[model samples]
Target: MVMGIQQVSLSADGHRAAVVSLRDGVPSIYLIKNPFERRLVSDTLAPTVWAQRRLRQVPRLAPALALASEALRQRNPFLRDASYTTPPAGPLLAASEPAGSNGTNGHGEAPDSTRYGTLRVDFRNYVFSSAFDEARPPRATPSYYSSDPFAPKDNVDENGRYRPRRYRLYFTPDLVYGAAGYDMLYGVQSVTQMMFSDMLGNHRIWAATNLLVDLRNSDYLIAYSYLPRRTDWTVAVYHVARLLPDYALRTLYRYRHYGLNLSASYPLNKFERFDFGLAYMGVNQTDIGNLARPPVTRTLFYPSITYTRDVSVPGLLAPIGGHRLALQLSGSPGNLLYGRQIRFVTLLADARTYTSFGRGLYSFAFRLAGGASFGPNPQLFYSAGVENWINRRFDSFPIEDLTDFVFATPVLPLRATDINTLKGPYFGLFNAEFRFPLVAALLPGPLPILPLYNLQGTAFLDAGAVWGSPSNRRLNLFRRDEHGRQVLDDLRVAGGLGLRTIILGFPFRFDFAWPFDGRRFLHRRFYFSVGLDF
Candidate 1:
């Protein structure tokens, strides 16, 4: 909005209308009276001063005066005289003073004291535009104003909204070289956001050079995002993830196999969604030696679906029951295709729920989760014992034959035992956690300190094992001597506790756990890691 003199007409009972000239735009309260007409007038000389005082944001004269005085002293050396330097004035005097104390402002004296009140205006305008190219060479465009010329008002709508005009330019002689790597990606992405009729739309295209890389091993990925104007859904695609060079980072590390995966997730409701995808992997060698057979290639199609619902219970758990129950179930079935020896299928299932309590000084929260995974593996079981290097307790078992049981092939009803082969196809996972506020009360003020510190702890247990079947597995956990007698135990369990300190917007986590039966398993012990057992 622009500010100017709203009105300058005389009031109904005006006595000169209380006019006061502001030499420096500093307003003053004036009480006017015309004795000849016996009229009385009183008003605040400037309404702007009242608003400025409320914010206390107006720049002060002291700093500017100090800077100017210093500059002037450096040029003339005479102002350094203590008698010539001016001292600071009181606030009242500074607010209601004229620009000069001498006869005139360096020019001359005042004119006849009666013609008109010269009101000084502090006018400012803010103009914002991104269309104009600031980098254009000066010679390319004729210069009119020494400063940037104001945007042409005619190009804007009557209501002042700029009709966006996108401009594109390309330059040659550009050294456009690029590279890519795994997880870390750097590339250029182009996108546009626009409003069409009553809809909002967005489109994006991103190309990454190194999706994965090594001199001998590298990959590239191309992805894009799109949102149409008619629906409340977004579509994304990872068009490609191609390997470029191999054996780049670790020449010693073998390239088991790398492939592509494509998946899409669409929200079914506020609390439910579904995803589907497929991934293919080819391994020429296990972590050990390359197989006598060239290389095994497996293409698996995984179709997954899930449902979620929130259950809210009131006034049942705490002083202020902020309890909610959430449920989720998802599954994936994978198939491996190689030689006539097609492997058994794999399936997984998971579920979890949580509740929150309290609101004031002391708050609490609790959560629980459980999941199971069963898969077939002809090779040794790919599982390792925990190792806590940060805490100095390292207990990791060397690789060994893992398959020790065998049962049968799976059926439609999907009994747990159906997939439990002596090799792999196992199941086990459990988790629970709780949170508590560590503060007693907040300070008294408009901006009060909340529970700046909080304490959270968790207890968890995990157990996994395989069954017996046609999937011939090694007998590591339960081995039989040449006499065919049971010679080893089979069950393993672990329990752990976690202490978390939430401070200043960050969480510090420390966890410690011990085996219920801390004994030797395959000549190695088990220990907790950075608290992330999983």
Candidate 2:
């Protein structure tokens, strides 16, 4: 029974009491801090002690906010990093940063290291992070930038894919209940029917939800539909939410008709994150009928901002990247109901980057987008395509090369009464596709419950066309075959192929497409599907 004590510290309220003399059991001291800050202070019975406590004395360089909180905990793992209790040797408080109670502060924790990025928007998602000073800026009408400045200025790709937080639930119910409640029925019955219809009765309900929170952190989408009409009864709600860790508050409501969005960000280091936003959109509709009959119209508003960027370049495969640029500017305000509107938006610069190309085993994906639409009815635009999957060669649907104009509103109409034959919006065909994947990678293994049901093949070609003419010239409004010519100015294609039936308990796929040139017989028709035709 022997014990001796000399000194022990830690009391300015950080509680600690220890003294030894009578019989061992009192000589204890604990204070652990290592392998990257793990502060522990106590009175342990010496289970092997080594003293030197100093966990984070902050002088900057916190592994880049711990790699942006480990890419938002690999896609939102709830997010947590707030603990406090320290006063011992005192002398701290002022480099403070860790706030998030709506007030939201910076850097939370959970990042050892990471890299891999590409998040740009133009097809209307609007976001163009940095200005990229390549010493270039001399065009006053078109703008969009963000092409992988090295990705990671706080990495953000809000589930366009980086995977995680993917959810979907659908339950359809139909029986019958009418009073003022459940009596739903949706539309779209066989748009070309490939078969898949019970065509249930009149009482139904549908719901959809999606959450891709934390990546860039926070994003949510919700959809709802309800019906009951023999006279009138319809309800539809759509919501979109985004808080994206740093700065962004996007909210959209489709009921009382309101939309508000705000964003702010500035990261001059790590890579780049210079966001900006200020939005206000409105819509209102009313018509309950009978009650003296008044409200027939509603309203609309717009104020926009979108500047996005998420970069990281270096790939041979598996990581080509997308959204090189996006820019938007909108204005709305009209009289006599609604008329004055303006839009100057440019997206997916460098032809809508959907780039994906692999060697060694083969892979490919493509895209196209050109721009123009200035002020009161100005037009000029474009689109192209390409997408291939090696082990599965030959499939189609890329045909896109467009030019606009020929509108009468109230649901699209080819209008032109002269203005020099309104030779405005030219160009044609805006969509195309091609794919081929025969035999599940030439299979060699797995086939019990038939897991790798090999051989998957396809061949295809499709088309689109639109170029204008017809001011006082009406050849019966268009479309004529059998040598009568004038088939909406021409340019239409469609090819065929089949047998991709790799079925089992059912991951199911069965497609058949055929439609060569055009004109009646629905134009060389033949189509069936479950999935993957192109």
- The number of the candidate with the highest TM-score is 1
* Candidate 2 lDDT (Cα, 0 to 1): 0.31
lDDT of each structure?
A: 0.35, 0.31
For model 2, the superposed segments whose C-alpha errors exceed 4 Å read 1-206, 214-226, 231-233, 241-459, 465-499, 502-534
Question: Model 1 over residues 399-432: C-alpha lDDT tens digits?
Answer: 1221111112121111111122223344333434
- Give per-residue CA lDDT, model 2, range 1-534, as digits (tens): 334555544445544444334345655544322312435574343211011113322223233233345555334312212112221132221123443344222232222211122322122333666667655785543122235444423344575544333233434444222211110011111111011112332223333333344322222222222223322222323333221111122322111233444444444444444444444433332222232534222233333444445453433212244434444443333222463343333221222233334431222323332223344433332212111111121121111111121111010011111012123223222222233345563343565454445444434344433233234222232466678865533343445554454444322333343433344323333332233321
Which 10 consecutive positions of candidate 2 have the poorest summed lDDT? 409-418
TM-score of model 1 relative to the true fold?
A: 0.43
Error of 1 at 161 (Å): 13
Model number with the top lDDT: 1
My TM-score estimates for the predictions, one after another, are 0.43, 0.22
